[model samples]
Target: MKPVAILYDDIFLKHDLGPGHPECPARLQAITESLNDLRQDERYIWVDPPEASPDDIARVHSPQYVDWIRQNCEAGGSVYPALEGNLVPETYPAALKAAGAVIQACDKVWDGEWGGAFALVRPPGHHAVKSSAMGFCVFNNIAVAAQWLVDKKKAASVLIVDFDVHHGNGTQDAFYSDGKVAYFSTHQWPHYPGTGSKREDGEGNGIGANLNVPLRAGDGDDEILSAFNDRLKPWTEERKPEFLLISAGFDAHEDDPLSEIRVTTDGYRQMANVLKEIADDHCMGRWVITLEGGYNMKALGDSSRAFLEGIVG
Candidate 1:
């Protein structure tokens, strides 16, 4: 098997939103640079992401929302960041390509053409709703990719896991009513956008399909590990999903300016290892992770490199 597929380009890093934005252009630069510096792995292949067509997006989003995004992108100016149910301009295409990369990685992994893949693109998609962009996301990339795997590829049940410091409300929203997918999230509760409450279980036939593990402000490695072993792992073992999609974000690192979770770069390694084993045992070693958040440059770079190293392991 070749090393993980990396979907990235300098252009993907060039969509700037000016200074003081936590979601800076340098975040993408940090990921690309970290991937370039890895010496232990030589099998990683880098590829530029193409724009996902409207049909590809319609799998999880409404055609009207898709049309709105195109209009915003065409109008072009600093638009309000998309989150949950609203999409601003300027963030449209960026979100689209970010979602495209995850879909591309999914196609690769499901085809058995690769062991795994990492989508290093950004303007992270976890907060974006199917019909609206939220939390700086215009499209729910991870959710869309999972939907395609379930509907088009006929996956028995796809597991979507998000470890971003912020909860993946948008990803959860897409699958909350669909029983064919499971959404598991570990995020700081009472944080930004603030929607991953434990009581927000799945709706209708999707009851028990959604699981939210909200970490306290100071919770760190030990607590995360406890949650994984005591709750996440046991539940996942019974579900035995055919594929796993990770919303990989390193903002939980102690040094990040983002919300406090006190996790270290090593925390990412540990989490990646756990997911890798789960995927291997229950999902034929298939997994695709996409970037979410990690504002501090050093933490972002270090944790990302650590994650790729674990993938290679």
Candidate 2:
């Protein structure tokens, strides 16, 4: 079996918002510790991620917006009101690497250098739009990678599956009208950023390409899995994606403080299995997963480990 690449670096720890910020460096630390045993396993390989160039990011974001973030970070960092967080000097570099990791993972998996890749990055991106950051996200990492696949790699079609507790408003907005990419999300509705209603499906050429299944506050693994098995399965069969990208957010875990969803470690495992099967059947097993939101330390760690186990198994 080919090794699964794990993209990570210490710079991620430096993109700190503050002492009490929920998206803290410790989150990555906890996840790394949980997967410590995998360090010696031949099936997995950890690699440092390269920074994304301005042009790579500009593929998804406007050039002006990209310059704005760099300028702000260089000028001693201040509060980014839109992002709802502080942008320290290190934030810019970390954000670049976060997006770059996903790009690299896409390249590796697409090239068959790895069976799959997981980008363990920070400043969790799912809320960032094209022009501005939001909900603590600096750049839409998954969106950037998705665009890269289409614009540079020339992948005819790609599938992006987001299972975060909150809607990936940024990602959806990126490919909402583009038929080359399909965005499917299962998130808690009437929540933060508030944009994942089923009625907000795609427009124009992308009319049926976007699928949103908004779950109620207390919905758990059963509801989420059903959405994947029923709604997403058929949707994917039609798309027949050339590559797969997952916005893997574990915050929906019952133990997480951020949301009311009750997905367990086993739930994530099952979800990964389903996703992997879809990739195998449609994409020739070409897939990449990038970390998104998962606040509870233990839950994030355990759930991530389980998800990876399911994928690599």
Candidate 3:
């Protein structure tokens, strides 16, 4: 399988949160450098993430929110993850492209050009809501992409797996009542933006479509892998999703300071391999992932390489 296209653009380099913030611009540089250092293989198709139009973003976001972000793009100030109330105004075009990169990734993955794709864009996007921006995110990238596949691509089933240390509340909120997409997440409960509870299965027709596996703080690879076997795999296999999207976050790594989940670098590879196998079996090998969080530079670089290696296979 050809490595899923990675929508890359240097413009994502300028999304500065502020001095010494954990979610710094340097993270992307590390990922890019590591990817470049690897030998060229048949699996990769590098493509610049073209800007996503306002209409594309509107698929999952409120129009007013999109316009507000455009107005605030260059409005720079204090950085977030706020120890104090520091308001850092998001730069306009940077947020647009970051969200856009994922949009393009959605298009590519749905078209079946590559087996799947990963968007290494930043100001990582899992935390942003439909009308509010928080947690260093300006747009809900994965949610928008999921909607595109359902609305534009005419997909009847979509599966989204979020492995971020923090619950993907934004993504959940977007699809809370919709059964067209399946949302599964494994995250640290009682963490930041605190939402994903084991009881949040879904509502109405989407009742069982949303699955939450709230891992305790400090759970390591064995625990996560068990959760995958006991929960995600069985559920996803039965659902037989037509398209799959991943909210790939490396913050669970032991080296990362953000949360207490202790997933190692090797665990990341194992999980990627498993996820890829699932996609191949169910979705005709159509899976797309977008970066969410991984603060420690070394951890992000290592984990990203492992993920790419699995994708290229």
TM-score of each: 0.93, 0.99, 0.93
Q: Comparing candidate 1 with candidate 2, which one achieves the higher lDDT?
A: 2
* TM-score of model 3 (CA atoms): 0.93
Positional deviation of 166 in candidate 1, in angstroms? 0.9
Top TM-score hit: 2
lDDT of 3 by residue, 105-190 (tens): 87777787666788988767777888877787777888888888888889999999999999998898888889989899989888
Query: Scored by Cα lDDT, where does model 2 land?
Result: 0.93
Candidate 2: worst-modelled 10 consecutive residues by lDDT = 78-87
What does the lDDT come to for candidate 1?
A: 0.81
Model 1 residue 76 lDDT? Answer: 66
**What's model 3's lDDT at 199?**
94
Q: How many residue pairs clash in each candidate?
A: 7, 0, 4
| Poorest lDDT segment (10 consecutive residues) of candidate 1 | 81-90
User: lDDT per prediction?
Assistant: 0.81, 0.93, 0.81
The count of residue-pair clashes in candidate 1 stands at: 7
